[model samples]
Every structure is written in structure tokens, then in C-alpha cells.
Target: MKLSDYAKSQGISYRTAWHWWKQGLLKGHQLPNGTIIIDVDSSNHIRETACIYVRVPSVEDQDDLDRQANRLTEIALAKGYGVKRVVKEVASGLNDHRKQLISLLKNADYTVLMIANKDHLTLFGSDYLIILLDQLGKKVEIIEDINNQSEDLVPEFMAALRIFSQKIYGKSMTKLQVSHLLSEFQKQFAPEEH
Candidate 1:
């Protein structure tokens, strides 16, 4: 840490931190470039903290989800981070109506989110999730880069569902069906509108 940052962390003035360093109270070093730096973790201090979020595709994969959550929690603990909570879910990452994930993202208790990868959050488009989480002042740490196995199916399924109006009902002639379907879709994924 820089001297200024360390001073801010200790809630003291920069000159006071320099005095502490000169008095041998705080550990620091002065480089040839005159840069002052402080080593903060001499007393086994652990400052990083995170919350774990795990997801799986189905109920049968609950064991895998549990293992992932436990692994992430253990990783957080090993790194001297205060583990806050281990939240697990059994749902498709492409599904936008994930109650647990929504609650976790909205939660203000933890800013760091530990997960297997972006796919564990949203197989459809995880960058959007990252943006949303950032708006909530949280960031993600992917311990393992888990690939999206069903990546191809998500878009294909959405396309099929969108064309269901014309394919199943054989009607492209009415505005009512399109409006009704749009309303249903919004209701399914945008419950906050209600």
C-alpha cells in the first residue's frame, strides 16, 4: 500500500504516518525513487471479503452446486477473506426469473461476489449481469472458468419461443397475439414492473 493509502486506512494524517514509520511503529519502506510504501499484513490481517453464489441447471445437480459453493467458500476463507454467505440455486443460467440470484445481486451486505465463472451467473449474456452488479457496487471474482455447456441452446430456444406465435398459432395477421405474448414475456422476466 502507498503511504497515503495506509494513512487513510489508519485514519491518520500522512505526516503522522511518516512519523509512525520514522518511530518504528508502522512498517514501511522508502525506495530510491523516494516512493513511500507500507506493508499492511504483518499482524495476519485479512481484509478481503466475499459472498458465494452457486447455480446448477436442475434439481439432480444440487450436489454439484453444493460442492461449488463449498469450494468457493473455502477459497474465500483460505485467502483470509471474511466469508459472508453461501447461496445456492438450481436453475438455468439463461432463465431471467432467478429469485435467488436477483436477491443476491441486490444485497448490500457484500460487494465481492465469488463464483465459478460468468456462466454460473448468466449463460445468455453475463456481461449484462456484470454491468448490473457493478451498478449495485459489487464485482465478481471467478475462481474457475466454467464453460457454458448449453450456450448454443439458449439463443436457439429463445428464437424458437419468439417465433412460436407464427409457428404454433399460424397467425402473423394480428397485433393482439404479439402484444399478449410480449406482456407475458415481460411479466415472466420483469416482475418489478408489477
Candidate 2:
């Protein structure tokens, strides 16, 4: 189809479609006379459109977030995935109300979600999200998975305990009390050394 027709079919501006083509995101070519053609009938065209997601724990990590997004974009392009959009957020992985992440999950325009790490999506419940995305006919590409490192568990557990303690006891629980509780909980549940 013509580029204009493809743009109209996708309900996007001609300039946006043109930019996608210029960026090598659209599978198409231009003729000598300047007419652009798009291969809308390709079997895996829509399935290859990817949305890159990157997140940082705080606003202070803005540079790290940018680096993550850039790295993910490079990976996606190298894998021949069409870069549809890049969503960046400065929120803790334990945060459940990340608006950008939620919006991206809801949007069906992209078939793949690319991230530098699994925890970039969430520190907890990430497996559930991956399973849900798979059931929805979508894919998640993790560039580097350091999730299995035992050292990462302590901080995540502390954060989770802090949040739960705050919710259960409101704002009245002291840091000392939370720490004591965490120690007791660990003593009861920690695996025994052989």
C-alpha cells in the first residue's frame, strides 16, 4: 500500500508514518519517483513491533534510565524488532501504580516489551506480568537478567517489609520496630545451612 494509505489505515499522521519509514521501522521502500510503498501484508509485521520500557528507582537516576532505554532500543533494533515507542519512568520497582507501565500494558499497538532487566518492570510480581503478557500473545525481551543474584534479595525484602509494615500499622511504626520484625521473621523462615 502507499505510505499515505498505510498512515491512514494506522490512523496516524503522514509525518509520523514517514518518520517510521525513515527510521527503518516500517518494512517498505521508496521508488525513484518518490512514492513510498509499505508491506502491510507481512506475516510478522505487527508481531515484531516492540515497545521499550525503562525504569529507575528515583528521579536522581535519570541518567541511568536514559542509558537503559538507549540500550534496550539498540537491542531491539539489532534483533530486527520495530521500535514502536520507548516508555521511561522514575519510580521504584516495588511501586504498583506506575502509570506509564500500566498504560503500556494496556496498549495493544506493540507486541513486544523490551527491558534491560526483569526488575525494571517490577521487583515483585514480575513473573505474573510476564505470564499475562505471554497469554495475551505478547513477548518480553530481557537484555540482562541479574534477578537470580542472592545479594539482590535483601534490599527487595527490606523494601517489601517496610511497605507492608507501613500499611498494617499506618505511619506509627518506627524503623526500629520494622527492623526487629524483619529479623524475627527471617529467624523463623530462613533456610537452614547443612
TM-score of each: 0.53, 0.62
Model 2 worst lDDT window (10 residues): 147-156
Best by TM-score: 2
Q: Write the per-residue lDDT of candidate 1 for residues 15-88, one digit (tens) a residue.
A: 75676678776677898998888887855233555788998766656777777877887687556555667789
| C-alpha lDDT (0 to 100) for residue 68 of candidate 1 | 88
lDDT of 1 at 165: 57
Candidate 2 has what TM-score? Answer: 0.62
TM-score of 1: 0.53
Task: State each model's CA lDDT, in order.
Answer: 0.69, 0.79
CA RMSD of each candidate after superposition: 15.3, 5.9
